[model samples]
Target: MSNSGTPPRRLSTGGQPPIKFLLHYVVEQVPSRNGRTPCFTAWLREELASGQITTWNDEPIRVEDTRPEFAIQVYDTTTPPSQDSGGDVDQRLQALAKALHAETRGEREGPPGRDRDRIDVWGLPLSADLSDEERIATCKAHLLAEIAARDGGETEFPIERIGNSFTFGRALYIIDRPPSRWDEGEGGILELLWDVNPGYRAMMVHEFGEKYETYEYEPIVTRVTRAELGNQWLMMRHGASR
Candidate 1:
């Protein structure tokens, strides 16, 4: 946060209007004292710089919001973002995901995709016992290997997560190869489904809003090649008579 930008204006006490403070979570126009605003601003910057304001566990500050010089009426207020607001959707989503992932709230906007059309790709099993951190690490590993096995493994190529959404709950990785077989009239699809669950609440966080899809069926699957299978296979023989 460089001070190269426009300086924050001093607020008024009696006659002047409230100055707008545009925080990422909420927006507000607040009135400040004639003198203490400078002190408060400096203190806030210091607190942020010292890794105090951002952390999950922080001690309460001694500063008071109530006073003749510093007082606010409303508990909460918000305003719509105007054009040329310079707001960042990615930053807001990251901040909200960091906060909301730990909470048990919010609603899903809709299904992940049109019934059975999307979210069909799969990979390794994500154990329910694993934490979110563990699951993400596992996903990164699986995706890395999958890409390395394909032409996309090149370092210069663009690689991204299947879907950049904040998801939680018990889920497993099922590579989409088997479903392609199922659609192709292959008989082995049932073997892959033995360990698979009935369904999962596939929740996701997006820039627009939160959404979820009842995940069950997928269309595509990774198909193993005959050459790869033959090299590892051994022919069996037996002698019936001496």
Candidate 2:
């Protein structure tokens, strides 16, 4: 431990930057409280098509017309343990979460009452666990469901897992690839990247430089009900107990 004169070895060559991204959505309209907002699932599809971002996993993302507005903030850099120890991994995970949270909305720049309500009232909670291949299958299922729902019936979207958390928004999906593992400093692994309805797309662009060279999409505006949002929240809090 006394050999302090030597510099530490580098983990990645490009001097990877920390996760940078943001999340935004339309909270309320001028005159309409009868659930005139859009669905989150629909926005997912729009994001993939837009090509402003990229995914670590090439999974299918479908947008349902019935889902609410929700978005995610993705980052491009993958930070690693400075010392390659267990604790380092934890730190990396925490960093990712902090980035994600910052992208979503931090203490100062966060959305106000109406905007926050949109995420809380319109969005649906998407939670799942699986491997890379399994995750792909899950995404396909979600895409199909979203498409079906858009035509008429209800549908669901897929869950995407990167380094630490899963993602579920148009702009957010592309910002950063999901982490394969976790950092020790964060104190917890990002088991999931949960997305609710009434997605977040604008915020990600504002925070993370738009990966327009990769993908971009617009927010999908559809009708989302409070009951549906409640169900989504329940699913998020209890992990599909609803």
Q: Which candidate has the highest TM-score of all?
A: 2
lDDT of 1: 0.23
Off-target runs (Cα >4 Å) in candidate 1 are 1-118, 152-242
Worst 10 residues of 1 by lDDT: 233-242
Q: lDDT tens string, model 1, 1-242?
A: 11212223222324534332221121121222222111010101111222223222254432212111111110000111331132442233223222221121111111221111001112123344655445444544543453445433433222222121212111222222322342353321211111122122222222223343433343222222322211111100010110
Top-scoring candidate (lDDT):
2
- lDDT, candidate 2, 151-177, per-residue tens: 543323222221112123221221112
How far out, in Å, is residue 167 in model 1?
18
Each model's TM-score, in the order given?
0.17, 0.21
